[model samples]
Target: MSAKQTGTKNRSPMQYSDWPIEQLPGLSQEEQSQLQNCGIKTTVGLVKQGKTLQDKVALAKKLQVNLQYVNKWVALADLARIPSVGTQYCGLLLHSGVASVAQLAQTPTHRLHKQILRLQVATMQRRDLCPAIEQVQQWSQQARIVLSDEC
Candidate 1:
């Protein structure tokens, strides 16, 4: 596909400050304050930063919290910031070898669906798959970023 055609069909790149805070559930007052202190006042900030463990650790240290706490917050923040990627689906994606939003975006639809279904069955979980697939499509269209397979 041509660049112009692709750009016209996808979601525009969103700014961190533009998103609302209410979408991110379970954020403690202290965590919120810490995020704000680090210029991460919105869900988008957390999503963009949380793509890497280094970034999460840095943010956690800044907040004086453990890495696991930051990771959970990052997952919640990513779900809140990105449309169609809910917490449950995010977990499934992780279980299916998708470690980042970029990886989810890069995944082909059929393979992603199969993996998601497999994960659902193995984990004994139920969730609507359409939204997650849609999210992957939307994210792929919007971002050219790809995830490295290596840890």
Candidate 2:
């Protein structure tokens, strides 16, 4: 049944971020299982459980991964909270220097677009594959919405 039919509002990640952890890029199957073992099977869980530096350090100790790995994973999970910039493009946004949804929200769209374009050209060797300006604008707008919802 649809959310409307169920009397629900179909909230976005801005309100309740909860996508499968596997959907976030770069996590190995083992890592997914490890997180799942800790009852963190979704992005929301990762974000909530790893919110602080101390939490991240504890997670690193439990998962037996580098502190940097846990930090990067938490960042990816945080970015995935933006509905328009979900798992698919969260990594791109990160590599393009967007460390958080708040950053994406405040960044000038054209500048962010240029950064993404430069990274795409340098790594993918194809500017054509870069996201369009319109899409980038949507991400920024959605990020702003997400941030506003937090307040």
Candidate 3:
């Protein structure tokens, strides 16, 4: 399936109550209950915070989840949003010294190629990274244009 189709198809129910919070890592029962109460049950819910640190922190607090956990959810969400990028590849990118979406977007093709090679060595499987790198570059260019327009 195309990435857009996969995204729509993979979407969880809109209601937070429908999420299986028990399956989330490192969440206590109390935290789960609090998250449900605050209308944030799915990982995606936690990741949709507006573009502000305070917003993310408040959301995390309301859900009784750690701020770091919320940050991680956001990072994972961003990686998932990237076409052809998965959690494993995201981890590999981090291990290869690319820690954030901005960093990944700004990375040169040569560096990205080297990182992917390193990841292949660790995983014993080759990953096609060109699509993801191209996507990042496109996103970065668009973001720059938007930011410049705002300024």
Worst 10 residues of 2 by lDDT: 1-10
lDDT of 3 by residue, 1-151 (tens): 1222122222222111112333344456876677668776554454455246998789777766678876655554444333334333444555566655566657775666666676766677655543366644554443333324334
Whole-model lDDT per candidate? 0.56, 0.82, 0.51
Model 1, 111: alpha-carbon shift in Å? Answer: 2.0
Ranking by TM-score: 2, 1, 3
Query: Model 2, which residues run further than 4 Å from truth?
Result: 1-17
TM-score list, all predictions: 0.55, 0.88, 0.50
Stretches of candidate 3 above 4 Å error?
Answer: 1-46, 86-88, 119-151
Tens-place lDDT digits, model 1, residues 30-111: 7677778788766666777776888888877888988987887676555333344443344445557765555556778778
CA RMSD of all predictions: 7.6, 4.2, 7.4
Better of 1 and 3 by lDDT: 1
**Per-model tally of clashing residue pairs:** 0, 0, 0
Give the C-alpha miss distance for residue 87 in model 2, angstroms: 1.0
Q: How does candidate 2 fare on TM-score?
A: 0.88
Question: Which RMSD does model 2 reach against the true structure?
Answer: 4.2
